[model samples]
Target chain A: MTQTALAETRTAEQGMAAHARAWLDANLPDALREDRPSTRRNTVAELCDWEAKLHRAGLVGATWPKEYGGGGLGLRAHLDISREIGRTPMPESVNSIGKELAGPIIMAVGRPEQKAEYLPAILEMRDIWCQGFSEPNAGSDLAGLRTRAVQTADGWVVNGQKIWTSGASKSRRCLLLARTGPVEDRHRGLVLFALRTDTPGVDIREIQSIDGERSFCEVFLNNVVIPEEDMLGSPDEGWAAATRVLSIERATNRMHRAWRFENQLNHLVSACLSDPATRHLAESTYRRALAEVSVNIELLKGHVETLVGSLIDGQEIGPRGSLPKLFWSEAHQGFARLALEIVSQFPVEASDTLRVARKRMEDIYLKSRAETIYAGTTEIQLDIISKRILQLKRKA
Target chain B: MTTDTELNPEDFVETARAVTTACAEAAGLPERMDLLAEAGLTGILAPEAVGGMDLPLGFAVPVLRAAGGGFLAAPLLECMLLARAFAGVDDALASAIVSGEMPVTVAWSGMLGGTSGVVGRAPLAEACARVLVLGADEGGVLVTPGEGAMVETESTLDLERPEARVRVTAASGPELSADAVARLRADALVLRAALILGAAEDCLSRAADYAQERVQFGRPLSANQSIQHHLARDCLAVETIRNNIHRSLSPECAVPAAAARATFVGAATLGARVAESAIQVHGGMGFTWEVPLHRHLRMIKALAAQGGAADLIEAVAADLLANAA
Candidate 1:
């Protein structure tokens, strides 16, 4: 290799390693407490405190433009930070909406004043946010959502309910996507607003899910009064923004989740260590699967980093982002299911490692179960691959 | 063998696809014998400067996938895998392999939970000069195929990658360096996975086609939601394996062989399930020897047992987890 090229590569690696180490050390939780899979709000809040630390340190939202009190680093920095944060079992950052989805979209579409009012608050955790998009009637058929927004001279009045709103009960703001077009224009006529969860007409009630975390809540927007400065993006632009938002979630987040699964896989390895034969056998199978998962994660990371690089250079990812999301989600599910199969015979809390291991598997299994269901289901991912990537004709 | 920086995966895949397609059209696994020698596939470790394709795992993987599909019934992969421990350093042997003149065999003896050195018959025993052996420690050795280098044909699941019983007295050839043995063990995985890729693809397409055309009740089996879902699930499984293979195909040995082991082992295990379902789709025809589905069933089982599938993938996972970044 040429000296100059070699120098450039070394500098990049050193910088990334330093950036990655800083984030990993600061964000990983100091401890892992639950023997059972836990996503309780308490766990989430503790995770948020780390984000608040990162916010204070100028590491969180470093990808955002510096005008909004962000670090304004590149995608490599963003990925390195995320990769590092995965080293620990900390709670998922509560400001996930702002740091991940809402911030990126708001930057693209929010009016200058709206940006000034909301962006800084979100980055600093002065206000927490939740997405009020999916409703009871709309899950996979998201465009069919019936939430309606009536235009007012001042702003818009929303009169509908959004269910499965993660963090709605605690959030200070909602990136509420409501229908503004005719009933038939399923996707086209939508508008987004940054309405306060504490607004007079807003009501939130937590629901019990299979995991029993109470992480998601139902939000009833009864004539929720929103202001003119609160609209996120242009009117009728919500669908596009939401789609971009989902695609971004698919690309950026799944890599770290895959990395986190490696820890669970490690615990599984320690399970069979006492028995040389089983250790040989168990470690053999699990190690190989872990290696395979690691390789795929690297591939996915490389892919997303490439896309983000192109985007930084003014390129769009098109529909291929679905490939990694679908692949990793299923891959994770397989990894989790494989863990259960390997260690099911162990008492629910056999080895401390096994007990710790079981919780990891269940958490990932639960999360992975959503992979094929959300960020587009497996079927949806396939459709995207077929129609968008391969451009295969739809069979009659 | 050398890593070809100039070759992209797409290009390697294209070459492999063409090669395998031609083989598939002709003799499936039955044709593997002549094809390996004809294509010089049994000599991948020979330097490209000496006439080999000289590719890393990425190039090797696609070729294996193609060969697996082609059902080229030969000890081609076994030869190349063992040959990794024999090339360059053994000038005469490597030169013969580069010229498509050397044929070799990989005898596990004690690898993959085997004891007393159970082995398969090698085609090159009487012809070519060298034979590679996975030793008592699961390490590999390249020894001469002369004198007490015994070879006997054992009953094999897939006739394509021929298996035989081998018994060696006190025979010896030029010993391989430790590094060569590691490379051989790793490539053994890639070789095994490549074959599974072909087998899995064969099973998936056949199952999908059968579901569309076969009729059980009034509706075509394809119309059955259960069947559609199964087929769709199988398609996803197959894609995951393929994705695993793609990642495995880099010049960097970090993932290729490891992924090959995990993916091939996983594919082989799950692939057998698909093959069983494939048979069910054909009803009675699936069981009868006249139908071709049994071949895949046999091949899948056969590949799963080869190159130490379970142990390798588990080891790979453990190592990866140990070094988590």
Candidate 2:
């Protein structure tokens, strides 16, 4: 690119970020802002509506093709928008599974019809997706799953029990992973389906979690029939396609998380300063710990931005994605713990802000317990780093 | 004799590596300084008018990294920083330092009160004629040892080039502005982080190579899951520090001050941890003087102590609190 063209591109990117910041600042309701004392619990419908608005404003799916209800911007623009989104304390997307996972996979290996059908629906918040890769017998060892799909004259029959299926109760579709081969054929003959969750014999039961949310569900696929057209890719292509999408998603998904982590830290400090009894928490007493947390936050941002740069350079993330996943999960969990400890020390006569911070921090601390357990687990990430990135040998 | 515009910072990597390796094998400080000046590394960030490259600060990163990784026992970072600090203010001195005609080191800690005070953490001060220290007003002043100043070596973890405590009976030199002092300190933090990163990277490579080659119980140590995990964590830590350093240098950093301090503290803390892990992977061999793993650890700890990691951490916390909404 010429110097002038490069300068123009930079200006345009800056405009993209400025536009996102302005739009979000103007549109995001105070009631949904997590940093505000007036913030209240938002209904799922309200969150979905807010997300659809974000899409209409070109704040969501900025990099997805324009033909698929997206802004058709470059990945840099998408990253710029994500930073703005993260700087604000907005709620997480209610359909992250649909937009980040299902949408990307369909775009990659989906039939043209599948992309046309599912991609726009995800951007418009018309569908919520629940991943079905984990089963009662397989969590981190995803390939060890026994969820079997048998092809018959009518369609494929899927019979399995999936545990920890987050958002299963509200999902319109399931990104179902099942084996078409024998049970012993781990990671082979695995097929993926955009299975309709309301199909006959499909049951969803909510599981109450530590944070008092029933967002997690146990899904029973009792001979549920999935049409042949719903299969994401050709037979036996599921494992490869899913892994590819997962590797990218692990790196690029939730790009705003680092910014949001900063937002949380800022909120904790501001809340502590709002009350006389809690002011010391933000003062010299917890200074070193807070500084350490601040460093971790910067490191997390560094990991994220570095990954974004590599991706923009057309480099394959592969197992290197495990770095950010491992760092963010562990660091965010630590921050959550620290935030909880500070909030727990609030005096009996606390300010309204302190109470709200205590409540949010309590939820954050409880929910963080699952952060390391999810997304391939801390142990799984460590194993991948050592075995793949480091290529450490194993004993014969 | 390439001008700053003719070369990118990355172009210096191979040259820096080669020169640093040569310096490591050189007999004494003068030989090492000559090697650095001959390669134009000592003046990497100095002004072109002073017979220097006048390159950006990024140009010094690779040189420092090579120096640290190769265990080049010279005050190269301090010289580069001091040369830049002296440029324009004392062009002759800058030119001298850049040309390897005069050796100078900076005392990272302590300030001169009135005309005399004790300033410490001057690396290899005995070999240098002058030492730079913070003045009473928090600016920078250059003091010539034995010309109304004295140097006392304080032997520490790094035995090869122990740091010195300088006592100035009379201070006389060109004074750097407060802004220049702050900029120099911030730049020092970044350069120090890069140096520590290089040392840690070398240690990690050594450990990984040893693990793959050293066998135990009919299998190489790399084959063991525990060793693999240990090395993996060290790799992650090293990568994190690298990323943090890059972030500190990026133009998009929103809070450069906080970011620089964080990078330094992160590097100091995590760099030492990685060094310890590398030593562990080497087993008893690492504890021996011949392995050289202890040298890297010593450097990391000594650097961390030089700037006082706890103080940096608290300052970072104070900054965050001060900026709190």
Candidate 3:
């Protein structure tokens, strides 16, 4: 309550805001501010081009090691850029797995040679990547995968199927988890490989989701040859390396999803220009949802900031990833559903634009249904909360 | 602007628990009206100069959380919210609040201007000597005995906090200006958020206890990993929502107006889930009137729909995606 304390708080607020503004001004391009929300507005090629431009502009890879093509800034600034990215709707960044999933794992456990090759391309978005972890029978129980990678002289010969592969069609390689041991070695035998998606033995077939975007694919790998050096971390240590994907420096994809959802909300509210009563209702509803989401963004930001602050001090977040991931995805799904409902109420002013957006919202809502189910179900999050934070024993 | 890690620290919670325990002992439980007056909790935001504890809304959240540890629900807590709003740095309202002399309540059932013409006046306008209403044309009213009266309706859930339909027959006292009312509404909402936070913490505790004690088939309910998991998950929801409420109150997170509706929805949604699950954990006993599970569950439902909780949730969710662009 003292004037000094109040003043100190305000000053800190301004400092943070200023940091966010600088990043936005420098990196958030004006070109992607389209009127309608498009799940498919940004393409893989376009995103790569923009990221390469960002790297050239010295704006990409904040927390990446100085050895890699990273800015070498700490995680606070890394997260700050993520918040800055939310302020604008530049096309979706394509190398998400590069920055979030692959890069972090590679950095944590990769050999020096592996980092020299893979990390820079990820920043440049030169190599599109997809995660081939979930198989037909394995989802929440991801350790029970059926993807088989057999040992060969050259490296490993992989022959298996990975369904629900995001961007498999456009991906150059995959951070794949395949079974090397028997079913009982569920958690132990799983190994990760950065395998070429275009190898002769690999086939990518699109699985068109409720969302019209064919981002999800059913990938088939038959005797696909993977180089020995491409594997991230030691053999049988995929899960441990995978933990890096949830940390602040590595979870930029979640940050991006949070940002994209925030942007779509603003467009929906403004575009509904007719019927004062309806428009006003739509706007009010959108505002409330935004407020809730703003809190979510801030919550995620807090989690990120904590992760970063702790990392700077050499502390680890461990299993708390469930909280942020579950919170954001559940909230994201709710927002997507709201966007669909609100858009449906509006009459078609311009059939082409409005109709497309309405249809898109519908698609996105349905497609996003899998997000909660994928990665991990909300139930799995509860499991983590109990066993980890609450320190509860496994059930009797 | 304020993040959770910075805002929700261990010390703040300690203060909340301390004040709540003092108030609980000072007054009675289950419905502690006297605690409001005993601890000057009735005037949490009233100026320190006027004998009120000069606490911000964020700090006050813990106090409310403490009171909720008991199953008590009463109008004294709500009165404190109005007092906080009306009592500025040196407002006379602060004096009245600290003394527990003045009483008032607000009506926001009609936020979209529908309440202005269609809805009748608040009964506190006459019955309780003061009334508060919010909207584009918003403000507090200093009512007299002749000004208004209420048609009462006791809620099935939180019976302690009685609601009613009011009719303003006369404006015997001064009318609060729109600006003054807006400031007060914001202040009051911050306080209301704290109160809800308290109630949510209560629901979580209740669920946790029931999980350990309630037995089914010769085993503790908590023995079920899934159920135990859910109870802890509820703890996280309440914690996150509480953290959000705290952020909304902080100077850095000065996203007050937004925080009000967002936290309300968050708490209500989570409270309902916890309440419902608590009942399920108790099995048949939870459904009986003797059990408090249904009471808290119904209370959350009532407050949730009454305010702009759902409406705000929908709007804010859209803006979240919107502002991203």
Q: What lDDT does candidate 2 reach at residue A345?
A: 90
| lDDT score for candidate 3 against the true structure | 0.62
Worst 10 residues of 3 chain B by lDDT: B117-126
Report the poorest 10 consecutive residues by lDDT, candidate 2 chain B. Answer: B1-10
lDDT for each residue of candidate 2 in A24-104, tens digit (9 for 90 to 100): 989999889876676456888889899999999989988888799987667788888998999898889889999899899
lDDT of 1 by residue, A284-369 (tens): 55555555655455444434444555555666666756756765677777777776676665554365555565666666666666
Q: Residue A374 of candidate 2: its Cα lDDT?
A: 90
Pick the TM-score winner: 2
Better of 1 and 3 by TM-score: 1
Chain B superposition TM-score per model: 0.80, 0.96, 0.77
Candidate 3 residue-wise lDDT, B276-310, digit = tens: 77777677888899977666676666666555566
Error of 1 at B300 (Å): 3.0
Q: Give the per-residue lDDT digits (tens) of candidate 3, residues A1-396.
A: 578865764554345435555755666554544544445466556667777876765556765766788765555555455665665656556667667787878777778888898888888777878888888888768877888877889998888888989888888978888878776777887788888887788999999876566878999988888888877776676557676555443323545555566556555554553345346545565566546555565554434444444555666666665666777777778878777877777675654455655665676688679878766787887777776766654343
Query: Chain A TM-score for each candidate, in the given order?
Result: 0.85, 0.96, 0.83
Native-contact recovery for every candidate? Answer: 0.11, 0.63, 0.31
Would candidate 2 be rated incorrect, acceptable, medium or high by CAPRI criteria?
medium
